[model samples]
Target: MTDHPNSIHQFKVKLINGTEKKLSDYKGKVILIVNTATGCGFAPQLKELETLKNLFKDQDFEVLAFPSNDFGRQEPLNGVDIEEYCAVNHGVSFPMFDKVMVRGSEAHPLYHFLTKISTPRWNFHKYLVNKEGEVEDYFFPFTKPLSSKIKKKIQKLL
Candidate 1:
């Protein structure tokens, strides 16, 4: 998880509260990174992330939700308001980061590091990063967060 050119651990991200977080801090943890849109139909899936976080809270697993407006102009809310909306509406308790462009030229560097294979086709796209900071798998937007496949992979990663 050192600063290998392709390691996800080398990047840092901004939280919704404007706090800086080093990805290296999560070196030994499995991470589920999801590009979120509050106004998208898949918004309900936020609850599944919360459920997953709670289910594995005692383990070295973390759910990192990133609000993005890249698709359909969704996720109009920003900062703490966006966090609040997701919590109140979808019971999302996982950490949410600042709004970020998850694709295209303006994409966040973390997204760049993650999309070396493929980019998020739409909202709610999920990426599974193993404890070693390597991407183990990717789930498309159509894949439900609570699907057996996702959970099974997560359990395997854990």
Candidate 2:
């Protein structure tokens, strides 16, 4: 129970491979946290996200994808299946977490904090976090990962 609004340091989420990773591990990196759905209209953004990762590999930037089934039941795959689909279909190379609800009472703690500060309008919503563990801003589901807005912000943070 932390009082700081942007303090994600205490949160721990599971990787796609079932390993627990503490948010603190990414303490000094700019993190783009996204709630994704495998079967949603915005699913193609996965490739754009990968492009962003490749574009900023030299910088201290990273994208942490969390597969969610909260919107229209779009993400129907389990943890293992989600990983496989992302790898095979999107060629996703960035780290992906286990499928978790991004909305509702059973949402993950990370989502709880994200939605508390800024609500996600739909699947593929992204929350940008600065290196110091502060929420920089929220991007809607339709916002492309490679958009100029995101690119500028990434540049500013890097």
lDDT of 2 by residue, 8-83 (tens): 7778889988999989999989989999989999999999999999899888899999998888999989978897
Which residue runs does candidate 2 get wrong by more than 4 Å?
Answer: 1-5
lDDT for each residue of candidate 1 in 27-144, tens digit (9 for 90 to 100): 9999999999999999989998899888888989999999999999988888999999998999988889999999989999999878886799899999999999889999999898
- State each model's CA lDDT, in order: 0.90, 0.88
User: For model 2, which pairs clash?
Assistant: none
Give the root-mean-square deviation of each candidate in angstroms.
Answer: 1.6, 1.3
Q: How far does residue 6 in candidate 2 sit from its true spot (Å)?
A: 3.3
Candidate 2, run of 10 with poorest lDDT: 1-10
Q: Against the correct fold, how does model 1 do in TM-score?
A: 0.95
- TM-score per prediction, in order, is 0.95, 0.95
Best by lDDT: 1
Error of 1 at 133 (Å): 1.0
